[model samples]
Target: MLYIFDLGNVIVDIDFNRVLGAWSDLSRVPLASLKQSFTMGEAFCQHERGELTDEAFAEALCQQMALPLSYEQFSHGWQAIFVGLRPEVIAIMHRLREQGHRVVVLSNTNRLHTTFWPEEYPEIRGAADKIYLSQDLGMRKPEARIYQHVLQAEGFSPDETRFFDDNADNIAGAERLGIPGILVKDKTTVPDYFAKRLC
Candidate 1:
């Protein structure tokens, strides 16, 4: 069996509020205002799809959000979104691999976000046999083609593959391809959930 995991929230604990908090301190924008105004628009999607460079995305974000900060400040606040790594999930994945299952990552993320996780959670990135990044893949999740690309490229059987993600839409997308998806509903319980079954 193959276990495909998502990077954010699933493997690495993340919260956009963390980013907003850091940005609010730097920009003097209230957290509520920042949260309300910040949008994951085309610029963000384009960044994840590797069309927009990090500098371009940051500039676009600052302009759209009316954030009063320099590029350095914006980059610093952006990195704050990552909270920590899921050690339990990583361990379970390793154990599953030891038990003969293939483990891989399929993440919808950008280059700016990439710089942080690897430094913070080296083990999480190394745990996977293959790490598929949206920026590198030129596509993002909930898109049928990305899922199709990974499955076909790996020659994985949909019946034997399980995708773990935190988003409902991503799960639906995988299901459309006949790939079973497990939603990481409660991050705390994810370790136990995998430990019991796959390993």
Candidate 2:
């Protein structure tokens, strides 16, 4: 069987609030304004979809938020969104690997995250047999094409694959293609679900 995991909140801890707070402190921009212009705007979607270059995304964010920080400082705050890896999740991946299951990562993340996450959390770098990022593919979760692309690229049958994601929409997307999926409600839910299924 093939096991596909979502990076954010599934294997690693991600808190957007952390990035927002850091950016607010560094740029002295109002949190509400930052949320409105950056977090809640189309720029973020475009950035995640690889429509914007790293420099271009940072420039757009700074312009929208009136940030005073240089690009380097802004990048740091942006990368601060990642907290840490869930060790239990890594252990689960290792266990799955030992049992001869193929494990991989499918995440809707951008260049800034793709650059720093592996460095910050080496487990993520080594855990997956392959890592697919939406920014690289120009598609994100909840998109049928992205799911199709991954399944085709990996040559995995949908019926034999199991996917886990924290987002309901992403899970639904996988299910639409006949991949059985588990919605990870919290840190323990995934481990619990897998424990039951794998045992």
Task: Indicate the worst ten consecutive residues by lDDT in candidate 1.
Answer: 190-199
lDDT of 1: 0.88
C-alpha TM-score for every candidate: 0.96, 0.91
Top lDDT: which candidate number? 1
Please give the CA lDDT of all the candidate structures. Answer: 0.88, 0.87
Q: What digit string (tens of lDDT, one per residue) describes model 2 on residues 1-199?
A: 8899999999998898888889898878888887876654677778889999888888887887788878888898988888888999998898888888899999988988778888878887687899999899999888999989988988898998999999999999999999999999899987898787664
Stretches > 4 Å off in candidate 1? none
Residues 1-199 of candidate 1 have per-residue lDDT tens digits of 8889998898888989989999999989888988888887889889999999988888899898899889899999999988888888888888888988889999999898888888888897678888999999999999999998898878888998989999999999999999999888877757756555763
Please tell me which predicted candidate would have the highest TM-score against the true structure: 1
Give the CA lDDT, 0 to 100, for residue 17 in model 2: 83
Predicted structure 2: lDDT:
0.87
Shift of residue 117 alpha carbon in model 1, Å: 1.0
lDDT of 2 at 92: 89
